[model samples]
Target: MNLGVLKDRIFGTAPTVALIVCAVMATDYLVNIVLLNTPNAYTPVSTLLIALVVAAPLSYWLTSQRQRLERLRDDLSASLDAKQEAIEEADRRRGEAEEAERLYRLLSDNLTDHVALWSPKGERVYSSPSIQRITGYTLDEFMALPPQAMVSEADFARVQKLIRGLTPGGPPATADYECTRKDGTLIWLESAYSLLGDGSGILLVTSRDITERKQLELDIAKALELAETASAAKSDFLANMTHELRTPLTAIIGFAEVLRRSRGLSQTAARQVGHILDASNTLLSVVNDVLDFSRLEAGGLELDPAPFDPAAMASSCAALVEERAVAKGLVIKVKASKGLRPMNLDGPRLSQVLLNFLSNAVKFTAHGSITVALSQKVEGDAALLRGAVTDTGIGIAPEHLDNIFDRFSQADAAVSRRFGGTGLGLAISRRIVERMEGQIGVDSVEGRGSTFWFEVRGPLAELAAPEEEAAPLLDGEGGVRLLLVEDNAVNRELIKTMLEPFGVDVETANDGVAGVEAMRQGHFDLVLMDVQMPVMDGLTATREIRAMEGARGAATPIVAMTANVLPEQIANCLAAGMDDHLGKPINPTKLLETVARWSGRTHTA
Candidate 1:
């Protein structure tokens, strides 16, 4: 708009424009003079001058405009290309971000576990859709809860402490808690918490339902408790049953032996008495077998070993079974090694095993002889003793051989019924043998016979002298004062009868209460106390008596004479201040032997 700036721009192109006009005019003059021959001043020059002034300036202006337009077009194309490139780069980044989001959703949505993100302020921010499956709560519902809603008030503080203690890339802490579901049902959840705040300011939590596992653990604990209680009950039942059975068995066996030994019956009456004694002895053996098996099963059975002659024990067992063998029209031969020395072994248990074999032999053998053999071999400072009972009988079937020693098992159920056995003898014997560090086994053919054998290691005793013969009740023992305390009337009368024959001045008391009163009133040299009585037990009365008369009680012997005859039962008697134990079904000889050993001094008779 300024005239001077306009003149500067217009005048800047004036000279170039004038020079083009002059050149064109001169060329036109020449062309008119030389070629066209129109050299007249007004003809060619006039036209040239006109063309120069108008067309030449116009061409220059148009040319300048065309160059400007071309440059503008090039710049416009470059700007469009740069814009397209930027838009394409933005689209690529957005696609990648969407793909990442899809992958995250795929992993989190399909899992059974609840995956969640919580703000550092303890607010639930993002929850995986699987939260619905695990907790019955949708993502929206979870997020809408209070910041600490994931944990109960009881657990909120603990969760907060756990969250605060988390460090980036450190081990995650795990804990289990009771959680409430959307339906208000209680469930257990095990959760792992991690600090995902390695730039992203949130805590990561992964959780799973664990209610069933907790239930399983609780169930297992109850099952174990029940099993232990059942085992204890079985042991108690076996112990009580043993005591009951032995009490009656003592009276039957003891009185039957008394009648048999007294020899006061007519010949026919004596035969019947013999039958009674035989039946009673068989019943006693059966009872003893059952008791042994029960104690072995309950782990209450133990061995008591002492110095004894092996040959003598086996011979004694053989002698007992010989009568049965003879009654059945069978011969029983006893073969014993003369070289047998005294050995520290459980003589009673050893005798039990041999008697079981002999009894079976006598029972099963119809016509052929039964052989009882005892032998010994020397080991290093020890003796390996072997005993065998062989019989020619309806032999066991090969299939039944292995199971014969199993409790309640026999060759057949028919065999058990016909033989009238509880099928416990061999089993009890096997356990007894194994406890002594011995082996018991059988070998047989179906029709010929069976042989049962056992071998045990024994410590040789220093002396091989035979058991001292039971001397007759000496003159000094004739007036030995004895107190018999028993609850059962039959037991008391039997004890009195057996002791009175031996010249013992025996007085009886019905129970421990009476016995204690009698002890206080009298000065008996020995008290034969019965255990398990009413009003007061023998153990309690013993303690009371010991306290009542200190030095005199110590000097006076108290012996336990009860049906409870296990070694532990005897040990209990001793522990209760009793001087000795005598298991009942009292044989007259043993009662007298115990009497002589305790009160009656052995004089040179």
Candidate 2:
């Protein structure tokens, strides 16, 4: 307790105590003086003693009262100190809570995500400034208008139903809806809403934009639909193509068989048979082109590159169409530039491109001459060999030229009906050339003629001379047997017949499992595997065969034969341990050549 408070308590107790003590002391002094004067009348010592007794009791009472006042002052001071500490603590806590609330308000206002507080009665209590970013409306405008104003017309009804279903006493419910921006663009938003506990009646809502996510979903749906449509169209085309292929193939195979079996047939009859075979081969080529075009559209085409003479390649392609040109009484010419550089090209694919151009020119030209030109042009430091097939034929319209490279599109419907083509040749050729990193284009005038051209770049180095010749037939002298695995009976028979002529002792397996069994049961030199089959695929069979080969301490080459010979598919086949690949329908010459190569025999034409 303070000294001043203690003094006030002591003084405030009473003036009566102070007066009593003073009277006692003064009486004692007076009594002492009287006793001295009346020394003879009585005992002066007794009077002095009585005065001392009175003063002692009064002094004790005054001292006790002052001590009691000091104790009361201490108690009052303690109570005041406790009250002041409590008030100071409460003020400090209030400041801290206010600071926290200020930070929360600032964050809520500045956050990118939309934040809003709505009353239980569905009134807009508060909205963040970010509402403008999401809905393109000012904060004040959003607060003034109904929340439904921002919802797209298509989604407003559903949003309303969802909002009405929310319960104040229940847990939060989530909803997604489309909202319209101020510029009339629609955006998707996902919102989470929950009720606040205060009786002041408020709910908290937070929303985020999902526009890009929604667009991606839509794009995925569209792509899926397109895939399904393409798949269905491909199935239909395959069915039609199978029928188209079998018709000509049957005639060719049957007539060829007849010519082989008959020794008495005349030269004229033999020549007719040869013509039929050529025509059948041409028709089969058309069917294959259609299938290839389909595969290319489905991203399923592959290329094989090897060294070849550009001049020789051009002459070979020209030879295939020369007869038709001659039949039409049209002069055909081939021109190769001097010192033409050899190139590393996909030989068969280049031939296919040349053949397509040559055939188109021959078919379209009635009397005018056709020319197949092979030349080398210097492009910077690189040497490029250019191949061009030009003819006086019915040319393309300017408007239809751009679309001619599209699958199943021709110059016109009339041209398709008159020419009887699948309209896939140019498309396939274009894709093949592009795959080779080459370019193809056409120059034409409607009534004049057309010139189709392509160019390839490679080293100008000279080719080494071929070594000594071997037998025409593939080597079976090693007693090596080949297992031909194919599902289609026609394809199997066709491959079997072609290989037999090359003296390759051939065995057949109808499916992948059979092929695997054949490899296990016999000492096979090679396995020709087809990809699409029942039970197990050729890729799986090839892997199994390779594993078995490792176990037996022997190695047998495996070759893949696939209708869908895509680059990815070929890579997959190679990855599965297949030695090489050949697309179907098999070319007899190529089949024999590959067989010779793997059978440890040099091939000679």
Highest TM-score against the true fold, candidate: 1
Candidate 2 lands at a TM-score of 0.56
lDDT of each: 0.81, 0.76
Residue-by-residue lDDT tens digits, candidate 1, 249-301:
67877787788777677888778878887787777677778777877987776
Error of 1 at 423 (Å): 1.7
**lDDT tens per residue, model 2, 374-477:** 88886654578788998999988999888877778888999889877777888898998888788889999987889999977755555679976543446545
Instruction: Report the alpha-carbon TM-score of model 1 versus the true structure.
Output: 0.66
Q: Which has the greatest lDDT?
A: 1
Candidate 1 colliding pairs? none
lDDT of prediction 1: 0.81
lDDT of 2: 0.76
- Which 10 successive residues of model 2 have the least lDDT summed? 596-605
